[model samples]
Target: MKQLVIAEKPSVASDLARVLHAKEKKKHYYEGKSTIVTWGYGHLLTLKMPEDYKKEWKTWSMDTLPMLPKQFLIQPLPKTKGQLQAIRQLCQRKDIKEVVIATDAGREGELVARWILQYVRYKGPVKRLWISSQTDKAIKEGFAHLKPAKMYDDLFYSAQARSEADWLIGLNVSRALTIQYGDQLSAGRVQTPTLALVRKREKEIESFRPKEQFTVELSYQGHPLTSRKPLVFSKKETAEKVKAQLQKETAVVKEKKVKVKKQWAPLLYDLTELQQVANQRYGFSAKKTLNLVQSLYEHHKIVSYPRTDSKYLPTDLESSMKERLQAVAKEFSLSGTILQKGKVQQRKVFNDQKVSDHYGLIPTEVAPNISRLSQDEWKIYQLITKRFLNLFYPPYEAEEQTFVILLGDQNFQLKQEKVLEQGWKEKEEGVSSLHLSLNQELPIQIKVVSSMTKPKSRLTEGQLLAQMEKHHLGTPATRAEIIEKLVNIQYLERQGREFIVTPKGKQLLTLVNESLVRPELTEEWELHLQKIEKGKEKKEQFIQKMKKEATRLVTEIKQSEKEYKDFALTTKKCPECSGRLREKKTKQGVFYVCSNPECHYKRRKDLKVSNHRCPQCHKKMVIVEGEKGAYFKCQSCSLTEKIPDKKAKKQKMTKQEERRLMKKYSEKAPAENPFASALENFQVQD
Candidate 1:
């Protein structure tokens, strides 16, 4: 009997099929003599929505604030229903005696496969194919030594707990706030706290008061020497006095200290670090960087798993270091040198206990074709390759020197750094030059500088990701998505490289309970989830605690005296309900919605005047938002044209020329046209 293998994504399933020799590709499954491979499109199922449980839960009301389900259910995603059905049929095939779960080797991956199995009621014997990369060698080895599906039960439990907890807390709180405030506002266990962090930083920036201070500096030779302790005098007179006294005296060298330090290379890229670096260097948002790296890992098959949190490799992977190094040696000179050396130094990067689901992101045995990669993909691949190559290189060596000089009653200090060896930083090291000798006294020049204290800079995407990592807000895989969600929901705005909290976001935070806006709650939940994964904690206990917390949060919010103001009002009136339209921000940009609670009128705020002129009116057509989709409408003759699914072909006209033509046509038009009489009658009515 043949075995059925299910992978997480089509790309991965194709890779598995190629390696397993399942060449005959059917509609949804690939068949071979011994096996059949099918795939899911990421997640085929998700936790059931509140409305899915019962009809009463459909309405947003305070009475149904805490809609806790005794048993959470899974529903097939609308877009993937066909794929799920195909998998079910494949699983129930009589010839398929055993099923293989070949999804990603992670918690969410386990949940993806298990939920399908539970829904399909698959009772066949099961095995799991766990591998880090999609390389042919790794796939072959992984299939040869497939593990039992029972081993990942705890992981599945943890995944389910996380999904259900988010649903309970996020949906319940969102409904409670929306009902209380008469606007659609959302709050989540992780997203709310992250928003609070940004708002907190903004508050700090707003309340910051700058104070002017003065400091004296002495120029010895060409180097400026400042006080060892930064002496910021509040009074400029005091600094002037010190500078004047120091200018009359000659400086004497008091002491000199020198130390040689070796700076080791940075650890390998976990998803967070990689996102951080990419944001800082290329101005790529966290989501953009994640997408780029994910493409490199999945589509190019060049990098290892991109969603790993561990920055260390498993000890067993050390056996393939030579092969990995050889793969990149053609592109990187450091790789060639390392291969020539024939000995990789054992560093902190190789730790068995530290590795959880996958090792650090690295290059696989498949050599990358640089010409085939996009610009962003090439840059990210280079980053990973450089980090991996740096592992085998020596540490950066530098001579750090500190000089102390006595001038009057004050002591001045100067530090200089000299690079003795470039080491791993050969291409990136900066140049430094300083001439100093011990026991040399030189003439001194003094200057007093005044400056004002500056507030802390706003958090960049990179800095925010680092903060999220530090606070354990979300996993590496989810942090980028969380940041994008915040931006989409109008809680955070990206101005250049910094994240600024919106006024609406601040109001939302003020209304939410304090516990819900703090990272401690999320961090505590993460700790419990980790314990659950390790079989040290029960999933039921975690759910029970979350239910109580959710109840308390709802009660606190309902009882609070806080008020929410409608700050997003727009001048446009809703065409359907004649209600006042309010501006709303989403991930896809801004839109306008009706203020009436029951009204479902909404439209995109962006409107473009298309070049396609109305046939009857002979006027420029404007793209108007409609119930179905966008359509071209003429304001003069009321003529409408349906926009094509593809790009509409039209003649280009300058705005000035169009405006002139519009004026010319409106002032003097052909009276013989049938629409002209209607237009004249409409104008007379106006």
Candidate 2:
């Protein structure tokens, strides 16, 4: 009898097959002397929808507001049904003696494999191969020590509980809001609270009032020194008076204090921290950062897992510290600086207790193709590599000098900081990190700086991520998607790095049940989910609480007296429902949606790409309708082309022009068609 192995994706299955010596490849499975390897396309199965349980639940009505099933059912996803059938056929092969689950080692990954197992009713000897990082060495070690499949039952249960709760709460609330408001609106467990954070920041910005404020700056030994105390004046006249008095007077040094400080480098990059840092530095979206790092892990096999929440490595991982360092040292050229130091200090960053599903993002023994990597990918990889090197280096040291100075009647305070040692911070070696100066009060320079009290800035993706992690809104792997969903649905938009709540987003928070808007309720459910994972609580109990919440939310919506006014109401009417159309705006373009809930009518904005090229820049133009009819306009060069009409006078070209056109068109003359055509005869303006 042979052993059958299942992996999450085809690439992973190929990796497993290569190592298992399964060389013969069939359409679906790899065949070898005693092993077979098959794969899934992410997830082959998903929980069924409401109508799957009962036909009456298909329509959007208040009677079926809460369509809770006694027991949720699993159905094969339509797109991957063929793959599911293929895996099922392999499970029953007579030669297969035992099965191994080689899916990703996480809560959702466990669910992906377990659901298929339940669907096919695979009742045989089962084992699991779990490992972090996709390196060949890690795969070999993981297979050599496969664990029992039953050991991860709790993880599957937790994942299923989370999924079911979302369906119950999100579907019911979204349906209720859509029905009550008579517009297409959405709400959810994690997304609802996350949207509320954006609205909260937006409200603060809207209500803020800015006023002129003034502060005095003084020059001490040519370096500008600001007062440490609250010396800000509400009036410009008051600040000017202080500045004028301090210009001619010299300050008296009342006290001098000095202290040496040691600062350690930041901890390693968890997925959230890495996303935040990338967004702040390179303006990378959370999803973009995740994708770049994921490619570095699975495609290049250079970094460890990217979805980890832990910033510390496991104690056992400390043994391979040198190999990881050497892998990254190839591109960074810091081997001498890192090697001359002693062995890894093995400080707080190397604790088993702090490590989660996987250790912190770090390099592997496999060297990355530095030259082949895209610029964005290199930026992400560089961040991970340098962070790992910080573990072996020493702490940064600096000295601080602070003193009090008396300037006439007003007391002023000044301070200076200078680096004493550039220990792990090699990036700061050439820059001005060290500059010491003695305190003196010989000369004085004063300038009054006037500024306005500004409102708090909008929330950026990084700030929202930190808020999500703090409130337990979503896990490290799902937070990026949660943010992206709001933007996709037009609830939020991005301006640079800041998040701006759209008009629709503000109404969404106002229309949802009050409890759903607060993060505390979702945080409580997350805690319950954790308890379920540890076997302290049952998945069924947590799900029952969710059902009750869903029912209550639906009932509240049905009875609420609040009315919704469409901020997007347009004069144009929807042809299907005859209701006033609401003009909705999104990143894609403007859209007109019917205000009637039962009407599923939507028209995309009337703008289309055209094959016509701009005469100046040779770039494709857009087709837009104007008062004079349809015309072609180029976005690149701001050139306009009046679309030819049947009434326009026509001219014919010579045989030479026609022959030239044929060759030019065949040679890919431009991104679109050139101004002159090769056609035997074509229309042209007189």
Candidate 3:
């Protein structure tokens, strides 16, 4: 009898099959002497919609809302129905002795498998394969000691609770708002609070009143007297009085202090921290960073798990330090330097208790092949590799000199820092050649500068990630999706690197329930969800709380005294229905969508990406068909390239050209296309 192993993705199934010698590839599975391997397309089954349970809930109406089902049902997503049928057939095989859940080892990953099994009504014995890295050694070890699937029931419960709760609150409240307000408005337990955070900042910027201010400073020999803290004056008159008094004063050196300062490297990369850095440095969206790092972990097999909340490794993993370091050293020439140091472990880098779910992002034992990585993948891989290597490096040291001077009985400080030792990096320093002794006298030069007080800046994607992490609004895996969903629905948008609240977003805050828009609501739910995961609380209790909250929110929207306006409406009308077209900004550039609910009219605004890249930014440029000709416009840097010659004749894509482009952008070959192609082209020696 063969044991069935269900993997999360087809590529992962290929890896598992290779390790198990399951070489007889079938249409949807690979079979070996005693093992059969199958895969899922991420999630083939999702919770059933409200309309599926009750026909009355099909139409969006206030009275029919708060559609609470006694027991949630599961259904196959339309796109993956074929995969679902294949899985169902595999589960019914009489020759199958046991089933293995070889999904990604996380809560959501657990849900991905369990939902499919539940929908298929499988009653067979089941096991789980849990591993952090996708290396051959890790996979072999994980399979050698497969655990019973019953042990991870708590995690599955937690995932189910989160899904159901989101359905109740997000769906009910969204329908009520859209119906009562007569606009396509959306609000969720997590997304509403996220929007509130952005809109709150916008309000702060709008209400801010700049004020006039003055500050006093003293400089000598073209060197300004500076301090770590700036000196501020409440009013110009007070600053003018102090400046006039200090004009006749001379600076007398009171104290000279010099000491060495040391700074250790930052802790390792949790998913959120890595996403924030990638967003700040490369302008990568949270979703983009997650995808790149995930590719590194899964496809490349060079990095550990990407969906982690911990920044520390466990004490047990310390033994693998030399191998990991040497593996990375081959790529980064500095690895030998790090290994030469006899002992290279830091307490902050490894602690048994701090490691949870998975350890911080680090390179696996797999020797990397840089030639296979794309430009963006190489960038993210280099980032993780550098951070992992820095853990073993010594602390960076610098020499600090602080001089306090007395000018008219007021103390002004001048500080200088110079690099004393380079650990992982060299510090930038600028120290003057002139030396001063204690009690030395110098002429004081005072200058008054006028400036206005500025309000807090808008939140960038990185800053928004930090805020979400601080309040526990979402997990490392789901937070990126939440941010993307907000952007997808037109509630918030990106203006350069910063987030701007749209007109509809502003009205959403006023219309949503007071508690629904507060971060604390999601924070509390997350706390309970964690408890449920740890078996400290019951999942049923959390679902009940969500149902109650959903009912209350629906009621609030039903009786709301306020109104909502379609701020997205535009002057353009749809050609088919003559309905007003509203401008929509999606991840795929911009589009004009019909405002009329019954009219299914939408058109692209010609901001789509072109195959050609900008000469400067290397980003894809958009080719817009205009009256004169089709021109290439860079969305990022706004560089424009016009080709007037193309106006006379339009270009068409040939079959050969289309096939070439398809080959460039597609993933691995299809599963039905024969696994022989995969095995024939690539072979792993390790």
Candidate that would win on TM-score: 1
Over the stretch 227-281, how does candidate 1's per-residue lDDT look in tens digits?
7587569999999887777778778778889999998877788989999999999
Q: For candidate 2, lDDT tens digit of each residue in 1-686?
A: 89899898998889889989999999988989989999999889999998899999898888887989999999999999888888899998888899999888888888989998899989999999988899999988998999998888888899999999999999999988987887789999999999998888888999999999998877666565556576589998999887787776767776667899987877889999999999999999999999999889888889898889899988787778767777767687765756555257538888888886788898888988878799999999999988888778778887777766777766665666677887787644332332334345546677888899999989999999999999999898899999999999889889989999888888888888999999999999998988888789999999999999999999998988887877888888888779888887766678787877678887666567889888899889998766677789998877888888766848678899999989887884433444345452465869
TM-score of each: 0.88, 0.86, 0.85
Residue pairs that clash (backbone atoms under 3 angstroms), model 2: none
Error of 2 at 206 (Å): 0.6
Greater-TM-score candidate between 2 and 3: 2
- CA lDDT of each prediction against the hidden true structure: 0.87, 0.85, 0.88
In model 2, how large is the Cα lDDT of residue 478? 92
Instruction: Report how far off residue 102 is in candidate 2 (Å).
Output: 1.9
Task: Give lDDT tens digits, candidate 3, residues 485-505.
Answer: 998887888999999988888
TM-score of decoy 3: 0.85
Best by lDDT: 3
